[model samples]
Target: MGIPLDKAALVGLFLQTLFYGVFLTLYWLTLFVLLKKTGIQRQLLIPVGTLLLFIATAHLILEFVRALEAFVFQVNTLGADAYYSNLASPLALASLALYITQTILADGVVVWRCYMIHNRRLLVAILGCIVLLIYGTSGYYVVWSFSRTHPLGNTYISITIFYTLTMLISVSCTTLIAWRIYRTHRFIPKGLATFLPVFIVVVESGALYATSVLALLVATLTGSNAQYIMLTVIPPIVGITFCLIVLQVHFHVGGSPSEHSAKPRGILLRERGVRDTDFSNQPITVHITEETEIVQSDMMRGKNSQLDSEGVFQV
Candidate 1:
């Protein structure tokens, strides 16, 4: 038999709390790295990242409130089942809104990063448009689904589509970004191959998020109460992925050669004025600050190069 909804909800809350702690640490670390290394700029990533963290915070608070109501206050009164089954509860509605909003925003950021990294290629632009449309429409249906007395019976297909599209968005964006990195890697000087591991780590980190979403989709489609746990965990997982990219880029860009001396000869060529043949023709302004720099610089260094005699290696 499936796990009881009340018990599942409680377990989900516990797991969510654990992940939220991790997310908090990473988010603050990202901010510290940015402010310490690169002062604030016009980078679009700051506001977007802040907004996502805010949504996650609100979601966690709401989840705690719901759990309290279900297990503590309502348990002896209306009963936990009554509390969990009441889809119209303010907490439930708010949680749904936050979840959908985060989903759209997170997916949109991934697409935007891909579009920018590829120099706004028409193909990426078209894909981004399609992604936003699906997310927007599916989000609307998700909200609508809740209004139905029997949402599972009336809107299961819509819900399924929403999760499936989210998973696709994650997988597609990760694949495209990884491919771009791999292709760009071919043009980089052999001395800079040391950075390849870091790049690969970023791509693999993204793949992990995609995998998490896939698991969520599977659990959702299987009608497993475990979906509750995945749902609760996703917000933090998203934050973790975002922070991992930011931190990885920050460390490589700001780190000293002595620290990486054991690794390879050309750890970061930025200080050495080494320009790849592919980037010699491009205009490069090196900015080591901001989360977007991870994509705009490290991922596509050849297209974006340094112009100063100071020997600032681009990317």
Candidate 2:
């Protein structure tokens, strides 16, 4: 809780570097998947993802520079505290700006996903944009307020509100998306690329990002030095979580031949329907098929097996 500011920054920088490596790997993988699987619509997603990665890169580089200034350049002369505590320094202000930008972009992606999945409902879109507006406004105010040499006591409350709104936006949008996907999963026929996997991906990715935000919020409220570490790691986590949803959803929809062959033999006879939607900012095509045949004989079948209207028979 009382960790030295310089020490906390050092740890945060180290952890951010590690997380950035993971984010880099996932970003490249996402690119590979999108390029391989998507068509012209791929343009819709790549720029946003690339922007996030770029911000993360800038953030890490900035942290490295700041760390150098605090530990190496300033330590022997002005002392590390001088560099670490000065919120108005160019590096300090720039770092906060990057964090806010990354947060806004990441939150925008989630809201976009929500809008698309909800059939582009005007209400959803409007509300999401409104909240995003509030989030960005409050976030910048917090940044500007903190940069002041003598911030008022209410500045802490503003910071708390900023993070609270972030968590709520993520949770609410994700819940809406998950609910919509769940409904679609229930209404649609089974054995034709189940939506459950998509549901799981949405929930997991959402939870991962939300939990990181919650951790940071907790640390901030508690006045723990760990907030520095949490702050450093969140940018990369946002990228990582988004990339994961894209990769995993890509695999579930149509993965490599080996991944496909690993599943039980099932013949999809006819395409019933296909719905185009956006997932984690990527275009996803969902195929609904009718009449799937599982190629397995009844070796121990005292009960007669027959295909039902839905496709498969019970044992």
Candidate models: Cα lDDT each: 0.69, 0.74
Off by over 4 Å in 2: 39-41, 189-193, 253-315
Deviation (Å) of 85 in candidate 1? 2.7
Worst 10 residues of 1 by lDDT: 306-315
- lDDT, candidate 1, 34-55, per-residue tens: 5544322115556667888999
Clashing pairs in 2: none
lDDT of 1: 0.69
> Alpha carbon lDDT of residue 236, candidate 2?
96
Clashes of each: 2, 0
